[model samples]
Target: MRDLPARLRELLLETGYTLDGVRERLGTVAATALAREETTPALRATRDGDPLGTLIRLWWLGAPVEAPDWLPVDPLVEAGLLAVQDGLVSAKVHLQPWETGGYVVSDRKVRPGDPALREDHVVGAGGASANLAQLVSRRPAGRVLDLGTGCGVQVLHLAERAREIVATDVNRRALRMARLSWALSGIDGVDARQGSLFEPVEGERFDLVVSNPPFVISPRGRFTYRESGFEADGFCHDLVRLAPRFLSQGGTCQLLANWLHVEGEDWRDRVGGWLAGTGCDGWVVQRDVQDPAEYAELWLRDAAEQGTPRYRELYDDWLGWFEAMKVTGIGFGWITLHDSGSLDPVVRVEELGQRVELPVGGYVDEVLASVGVAHRLSDEELLGARLVLAEGVVEERTGPPGAEDPSRIVLRQTRGLCRTARVGTVEAALAGVCDGDYPLGPLLAAIAELTDQDAVDLRVRAPEALRPLIAEGFFHISTA
Candidate 1:
């Protein structure tokens, strides 16, 4: 095995084979043999100068190739360093870098163990990866579960942060590849198990659970790496339903998923209903929606580009499946669940028109900040909250000259959370006097005297304006 690399090097030079070309040849050689003999072709081709002998030698090794390596092998495979992985696999690594205890890095493309499958295109680290990474609460936990551990990217990332990490997948090939990638990458202490969802981890619980499941909604399971068995929306539903049992109190489950937009049902309520009585605080952000035709075409192109034939047939099948299920469209997004069951857990639905660049080491920070703020201010407590006007906030008033002293004054925030507040004269006067020194009562008194308004009445109304301004981020209060 040690001499394998040298022989492989020689074969490449003699054949004038590029890395990708060699990988393809190796995959084809491997597919004919047993799983145990998978890497024999590349090893023999390297050892012997005769390419035919090497090919025959691979047959003796018992490994066989079935697919091409759409994934690539570059710096990762060159140094026997990191494992070669797909885009989704790479995205998991990119998303949760902190879990690795150091920065996670990978080439955009790399080769798989099989050679016949030599040329694969990987999508870039996308929004789903970023969102899952961001939703990860950084607090250290005892055990982390990376469900559907494709290429073991999530497992590698989690190994850095969690005391123990377990990665589960249903594909034996993916599991094998993940193990090789793990070894190649030099990431230690990750247990790569093969099973669907939580099957292997039955009766096991974790402090944190993260997944970028095969949530693609398809008519049939075309590709094991990308599609799940639950049919349409079943993958996400099962994940959400099953997560509560595995999560520790106050722990979190963060995932990237695709859900169907069914006819006559709002997507938000559909997902929201999945969380009812789960005792989990849920945040689901729907990033994009594609109609049936568009969705079918997108995945069809994906299949065709991956060298899958029967493009029109596959496209028709996808449409027929969606039509049968009454699925109008596909909704792609992220969902995070915290075990802490606040009476009113954070549930927000917004459309991100386009992708936003994810901040490094900023995901956990944002989650913590939102949780802290949400816990601190619940319901009526917000009414009593006192805040100072933020710096760089300016009042802009626009109206015709002598136009009843202007209809309204617009208070715009220049930093923090971008927000704008329109204020009535009384509210405007109160905000103008807040210099971060006076308490709310004292400031309201002074404003009342200046404007000739009743102090008690001013105090009561003043808080209402402050509430919206503070909440909208037009003003921020000093912690002191």
Candidate 2:
């Protein structure tokens, strides 16, 4: 059993069963179909009795195939990774090739028209998992913690830069699968513990903490991987409030979470209150919102409960709970907290539904730094500080091309958040000349002289205008 993972890894890689190998063999069409949960195309593509095809049919498609001679059927079945019935072998778990050149083992996906999921079913790489992976800072760290690591997807990414890693989960089965994943990926030295969020790591601090927790706001805690057993977004709130205590100075914590939007309440403030006193700089980006009905249907389909006889019953229960709890809608997004160890922590919450760049860890690091600088610096200090337009930023003017004075001026970024800001003539002039060579005060004074405005008022209002740009990562505090 102990050597099973290494043996599987060697066999898998040798048989060309890696992520790139699988994709190449399946081709684009079959791979796309598989992503949609339609396996017929992939099955057709892998009809040949080759090693890679056999592996795909058995593990990737969850389809039983004949145990070939080269396969270690006895050892795999003995290790509980495979089952053999009348010589047709099938995987007991979904052995997926992750993008990080690793394998993630989880319970087979529950698709529509399939049986209901088990309570402790561990989930694989889904949208939320990928989102949190992209959102976490990849900077090298002394120690890292992956809280509520379902199948340990985050741990794979963290392993690249973290000297030590600790992964915790309430579901022991998940921890088991995570260990398998880490071992299969050749990632060792990870401390896997079984306990609910922060419980196993009490009195310890990590340089980075990341979670794609069971943040679904649900009426019943049926799924251990998706529900926290807490009432109405309280789990997410508690996670946020409790995060600061476990973060080392300058450490960061990030998670993908869902929050309730009750009637007559601002969702921003509702989520912002989670970070108000956490002693960390926080940033919340609400990427999407779904009303109660939509939210219920999404999760129902997620568990493959849509066509089941109890589908209506479960849906009604969820909707009834939402109504009783006054949850008009639900907002899903990313929450990031940076332990800046400051007396006045800066917390910013806003909606960002627009498309942006991926692997946003570096961008997020910049955002935290810029927001902290914008928050901590005084007006006079901001004026004296040197500034530069961030990379990929371009200025645009509208209102009949060739007109003497444009009706609108906009500064937009082509990267990171891809944020756009409308600016006045003074701001436009400042943007054109801010090359990090001069202080903002002198530039604003020059723009004031050119635009016939008071330098004092320009300097005061400029900081207010620049703060948003800085926070959005459109501007940088020049280090030059």
Candidate 3:
């Protein structure tokens, strides 16, 4: 395996075997088809004399092909990573270039009808992988931990700046695959372990922790990568509760999770209650919601268990489980917890239905940092702090047609969460005038004079008003 990295790198560089190179060789139509897991188009394009083309055709698309005598197949076969059975060199694992640089190696991409799919599947770059990677702070840290590190996708991102990376998974196969991916990416020094949750790091702590845990709310664990084999989102709930304990002071943990929305039960309270006694400041951003039927069907199709003659039986069983639990919907979101060491922890649970930009990690770090600052500051100190509107926050004014005094004024975010905040005339004016130049107290005093309102009253209420706006990324409190 060690020699394979260097050999692979040499061959790839010699052949220009990159994501862009493959796409260019295959063209748009075939590239798109290959992306959809259809090998026919890619097969037609890669039968040329190029070693890169042959490698892609045989390894990535999983299409059987005759190996040319020019390539070094013996080493890969001896390493147990490939097998040239039936005159066709087949990759034992899937290898594809990351959209960025480098490559990700994981279990072969399963087609819709592949009956040989294993139960303990280690997937790569699924939706939650992208979400968790984007939610986590990329800032340099002393050490980082990735729990449930399937394919070690998050470990690759954490390796950018983390001094040392530790990745743990219940599936040992995933840990092995994770190490393979690390080697494939031309990086090293990840402490990979086989264990569930924090078992491997019992007494250890870290500067950052990240996870895209097995959070699918499954009645049974039919698959290893998605289903946790836990009842009613227990995996997610427990991980959220347990992650904060292994963080150093002021350290942060981020994860992608799903929560059940039971009948007549508020989701915020259900998920929020999980953070009790954790002594960590927490924020939950709910991005998607699916009803019982929609949720069941999505995972069913995802596991490739749909459209079979037995589908009706499994479908009915899933619906029955949901009905028994009175689960109305499933909520999908990102969670960020910070060990700020505050006496009174701050917890914010919100749902942002609007589409946001990818990699909102910057906004998350900002929000958590601002929340810590808010907790540390006195009311007087908070009122005296200078603030400014965040970038991409624009003010919009609208009202009934022909009305001179606009009855509605909204602050809309063009990035991050893409949220809109409705503000009255006073708050709107305050947001407009804030330029990180004037402190909140003085600014409100100036507004007091213009509006004939009492300065003392404004000062008292201003801190409370700006508190949420700051935490929600509507405004920025200048620490400089």
Candidate 4:
């Protein structure tokens, strides 16, 4: 078992089975079609008898083919990666080529026409996985924890920067496949453990922690990968509450989560309440909202049960549960907690539903830091602080193009969250000239002089108005 991963890696690299190689081989049409779970185009593309083609057929498409002479069939079968029947070979698990040179090992994806997924089925990298990877800060860490590390995708992302990584999962099958993935990816000494959530890592602290946990709000916990056995969104709430205990001071924890929007509650307060006593600066961004029916149908289709005989029964039951629980809607988003060790931790809960830039980890890091800075600074300190307009900020004036003074002035960001702020003439003037050269008090005083307004009143009102812009990454306050 130990030697097989090396041999398999050698074989895969020799056949050009990396992510770019496979995508190039499949071409644009077939590759795009395959992403939509339409297999016919990819099946036609991989009919050739070459090594890469044969690999795609057997492992990627999950199709059976005659054993090729060039490949070492015996070692693969011995590794339990493949099975042979009547002179044909087929993949027992999905060996997917992931980012750069990594491989993710998991159960074969259960497509629309495939058999129902097993209860312990381990899924490969999906949208949520990618989102968590993008959300995590890339700063080097002494130790990292990947909670619920199914197939170990986050481990691959953490390997380059972390000195040590401990991956935990409740499902033994997921831990087994994750070990294989780490071995095949050439990442050694990943401390893999089997336990639910923080149970496996109690009394241990880490510099960073990330989880794409079983956050699906479901009535039944049939699927270990997506559903927690806890009722409603309790699993997510519990995970949030327990995270700060395992985090070293100045460490960070980021995860993808779902929270219910009950009939009588504002989701912001409900989710914010999870951070009350954690002693960490927390940020929750609600990216999407789904009503009861849409949420149920989405997960139902996820298990390949959309067209099954029990489809209606499962669907009805899911909706019934939602209705009985008073769940008006479900909100899906990213929750980031930074263990800043502040005596008074700041927590912000807001919604950003528009499209934003990718690889937002740096943006997240900056936002959390800025939140702490903004929260700690007194009004006098804010006025004395030098500030600069952030990069990618563009100013626009609207409402009658030829008018002497535009009726509306907007400041928009081209990067990060792509947020916008509407400001009055004084704030607009401040934005145009804040280059971190002078303190905000002097700058606003100059703006007051130019706009013919009361300088003292301007100084008092400007700091509060600009606070949101600083939190949203539209401006940078110089701490130096």
TM-score for each model: 0.64, 0.98, 0.94, 0.98
Q: Which lDDT values do the candidates have, in the order given?
A: 0.60, 0.90, 0.83, 0.91
Off by over 4 Å in 4: none
Name the lDDT of candidate 4: 0.91
Predicted candidate 3: what Cα RMSD to the true structure?
A: 2.1
For residues 229-315, what per-residue lDDT tens digits would candidate 4 score against the true structure?
A: 898999999999999999998999999999999998999989999988899999999999999999999998889999999999999
Candidate 3, residue 396: CA error in Å?
0.6
Model 2 spans > 4 angstroms off:
none
What global local distance difference test value does model 3 have?
Answer: 0.83
Question: Which ranking of candidates, highest lDDT first?
Answer: 4, 2, 3, 1
Give me the candidate number with maximum TM-score: 4
Off by over 4 Å in 1: 1-131, 305-309, 341-344, 354-357, 360-380, 388-479
lDDT by residue (tens digit), candidate 2, 387-439: 89888999999998678999999999889888889888877787788889999
Q: Where is the poorest 10-residue window by lDDT in model 4?
A: 471-480
Q: Write the per-residue lDDT of candidate 1 for residues 198-310, one digit (tens) a residue.
A: 99999988889999888888877656666775667888898998998998877788888888888998988888877766777776767788999998777655444323455
Between 1 and 3, whose lDDT is larger? Answer: 3
